[model samples]
Target: MHSVCVLGLGLIGGSVLRAVRSAGYPAWGATKSEGDRDAALADGYDVEASVEDALRRAADEDALIVLAVPLTALEEVLRQIRALAPSCPLTDVVSVKGPVAEAVGRILPSVRYVGGHPMAGSTESGWAAGSAELFRGAPWVVTAEEETDLTRWAQVARLAIACGAHVIPATPEQHDATVARISHLPHLFAAVLAAVGAEGGPLAWSLAAGSFTDGTRVAGTRPELVRAMCEGNRSALLEALDEALGRLGAARGSLASTGGLAVTVDAGHEARRGFTATPQAGPAEIRIDLKDPNALDELLDLGTLGGRITSIEDDLAVGEELGNP
Candidate 1:
């Protein structure tokens, strides 16, 4: 097992450190927050005095460096990594992939970099709210661009698997576009829904039930964190936002003119059913040989088809296609 060093020990980063260490891989982390540092240290985990110290140690030990920082903090963190451990194998658990990939390319081009985003989180933030099991059974995307370093990709995928997530290979652009709809858009919707519900005042609050609670659950996430994620993928989010607005506008028009919402309601119900059904359906097995020249292409195609890698053996990746019936 490759040793791991994580920067930004809050939430996702803290969870990664806990899970990675629990998996029997030597792991250590660093955080700028004194509270988080003290908390993690009190919990018996190894935490360096500073990011520089952690990076220096990672360089000496040839550890895999995981960037768990927010997108707004990414550039500064990348610069620190470039100065302290320029050649270290690098990966990230940031929400947005495209911007992070671009930053890595520009700032640390010589590093063995593989972008990653684990689709798991809580409305809560900080080290205290993190759990080792946070990513269990989640879809962890590993960016598989044409020029990606397959070896480094495999290492990052292995770490994600160790943290109990299935690896989904995708290009950074694909990851960003997909997440803009599924993750970022939902956060925006949740915020809007929560605000609308609150506008109903005390009566609405008293009458609120499962639907309202579930719909606005992510609204509880830290505002700055949500802002960072949504803003970081501005281009993709704008596209998703436009489509959502169009749908909502059509629904509003129908409600005004016909006094019915059958079209919008039925479409949404069916889509929700489909979303629920996909994971329950049995998956078909898929295998790809890493030695093949087109292996990366095959992996990305599989991901587009909703495939996920369960494990890698030698040069062969064993996975399952979950999208197709």
Candidate 2:
């Protein structure tokens, strides 16, 4: 991999810089904030004072630029990069992909843009909270559109893997939609819960336990950042919110009508069980408890016809069950 130049030395950007530098890659950073620049220098990182200077140095050194700025600030940076290093392939760590892709398409028509979003980070903000291990074992979604440069996308994926993230490929639309359900809606939900809990004042806080704290943890995130994310993907977020509200409404109706929450609770338990089930390694093996006379033959026929079966055994069955009349 080539050297990396990360823009915006906040938590995500700082973490990227640290991880890349630790992996023996030459890494440089550029931040608009003077205090952040000073802090990066104090941490012994090779950070430039300005984005233009950083891009100039990185271009000369053949480094891949990683845009780690917020979605709202991305267009300006994209335009700057357009003026500075228009030909170089770049990637971003923005939370929303659709908006970034659209901005890149408009500002950087000629440059290769690899849109990425790492499923990691904490409620904390700024470089002080950044860690080299922040991305370890996290899913980093890389958006590849129809006209996407495959080589550039792979380069971004390699960078994510270097930071210990598993690369997940998706289109910008797909990425935005998935994160709407998994990330944006959850943050909104957490915010609502936090607001409700605060209604009870000191007593609510005193009574808060693992469930309350854990569920509302994301509400501690920077308000501006969360607002930007929600606004950037508003359409998808609205869809997710509607679906969640519909489910909740149904659950409420079920509880009121039946005078019991077992149906809703049981369905939730089963869904959660399936969702949290540990993934098994290797090829899936199915065990059929045959009660019909021709069930064994039917299963064998399906597997054999599909050419997916590697082995078969009738020994698991009791002698009486397997015996012919």
Candidate 3:
């Protein structure tokens, strides 16, 4: 097993570090907060005071370093990692992927960086709130770009699986587009609902129940974190918002007519039924940028990428598809 080290030991990162350590692999956490460092030390876990020191330790151990930080802090973190541990196989748990891949390309061109997003968390946060089971059975998305190193990509996927997550492979762009609708739009809607509920005065507070509280639970997440997430993938989020607004407008029109909202509500229910069970790992996919002349050669060299070539095309000409491996 590759040694594991996590940067920015917040909720997600701390949980990952704990999970990795519990799995019997050596793990270390790098934190800027002295309080957090002391707290981890008291818990009998390895903690580093600086990324430089952490990266140095990772370098010595040839560790897979997970950057579990905010989207805005990614570039600087990548820069620090590149300066200290240039050869480390790096991956991030940031929500957005395209922007992060772009940042990695710019800041750490030589380092191998795989993008990841674990679709797991609660309204809770901080190291104390971290749990080893947070990612258990969760859909852990691993974003592979055209230039992604397959070896490092597999390492990241294995790390996710070791954390008890189901690994799902996707391109950075596809991951962004899908999560925009499923994740980002819902967060916005929750905020909107919470805001409306807050404006309804004491009567609304008294009337609040399971439905209202459940719907608005995510709305209570840290404002700064939400802002960073929304801003990081603003383009995808805006597109998703437009689609959501269109559906809402249709629902409004139905509410005003004799047809009512039964169809709209039913459609949502059926769509949600598909998510009743945990999804299995679909397939291993490797996207090659045809724009590169040597891409075909690289594809031919990828021996164990067991996916069927259901669709063979570029990003501009055709869309990415999921098929058997």
Candidate 4:
């Protein structure tokens, strides 16, 4: 935890560098290019550009090592680090844990590795996108395993806390499942919906206002990044997609019936009223469906829920009654 080597000086990696420095830990970074090195050093990050220099500064087996690269590059980096700094407690910020962790155990059996994913980041990149507060109050998921060293795991948790993140521990399988529902599937649906809306070109899009903007905003980020996350967590993502498609199909069915849509809307309203809290400071209020477990967490950032709350008329929650249909 003294000196840390952060691989990939992109948005999330650079942010971790900033967080490490802020936490009073000596931090260094590895980047493939000189420009990224210059950017990290120039940002006053306790970050050195070269892995050798970074490792020297942090000094081996004691420092934490974070792989901030994409999931695809995880194995290569893991093998490299295993040779370079074998004793360091390694972790990654990759969105999908299953693939990365499995790859690590299979490819580099000697290294002590734990899978990590911080549910925070901006669409922006490079050194300038780094933020010490990027992880503040964000859910930093740590994947738990039976063979995991508890003491080493604590070191990882310390970093999460130091970064201002709220820590949540889970098995890699459960972590993947939860993230598929909360993160991946949403991005997939959003991208598809945005693509549909873009079909008519400028005229079709010009009519899209705030609602459209808010709905598909995430689709604007790097598509490959989204795809990598989903593909890496394919098993969980597939299960989540199956469940989500069922909801859509059921909604379509309800819409086709006389007053069925109203029934569905009413049910949403009723369930929302019980679970969601009212806004504390908004002058105007609106109700929104809040069956999603992450709704409240998201609402904390949103200025208001638009007074949007609802109750299920039949006392039924769509995904609740039928599991993946």
The lowest-lDDT stretch of 10 consecutive residues in candidate 4 is 316-325
Candidate 3: TM-score? 0.80
In each prediction, how many residue pairs overlap at the backbone (N, C-alpha, C within less than 3 A)?
A: 0, 0, 0, 19
What is the lDDT for 117 in model 2?
88
For each candidate, what is the lDDT?
Answer: 0.92, 0.78, 0.78, 0.70
Which segments of model 3 are wrong by more than 4 Å? 257-259, 277-325
lDDT by residue for model 1 over 93-191, one digit each (tens)?
998888888899899988899999999988777899899999999999999987887888888988999999999999999999999999899999999
Candidate 4 lDDT for residue 65:
83
How does residue 301 of candidate 2 score in lDDT? 41
Q: Once superposed on the true structure, which residue ranges of model 1 sit more than 4 Å away at CA?
A: 278-281
Model 4 C-alpha lDDT versus the unseen true structure: 0.70
- Which is the leading candidate under lDDT? 1
Clashes of 2: 0
Pick out the ten consecutive residues of candidate 1 with the lowest summed lDDT. Answer: 274-283
lDDT of 4 by residue, 1-325 (tens): 3667788888898889888888888777877656777887776665554666565544444778888987777777766666666777788898888888888888778777877788898887777877989988777776656666554555675677778875566668877888898789879988988999999799978798886788798899898788888898999999999987887777788777653776557765886684475534434332323344443332222212212111122211111111111
Winner of 1 and 3 under lDDT: 1
Across residues 154-250, which tens digit of lDDT does each residue of candidate 2 receive?
5776778778876566677877888898789989999999999999999999989999999998898889889988989998999999999998898
Model 3 lDDT per residue over 18-121, tens place: 99998888899998767667777788889987888999999999899999877767778887888888898899898889998888889888888888899898
Error of 4 at 145 (Å): 2.5
Ranking of predictions according to lDDT:
1, 2, 3, 4
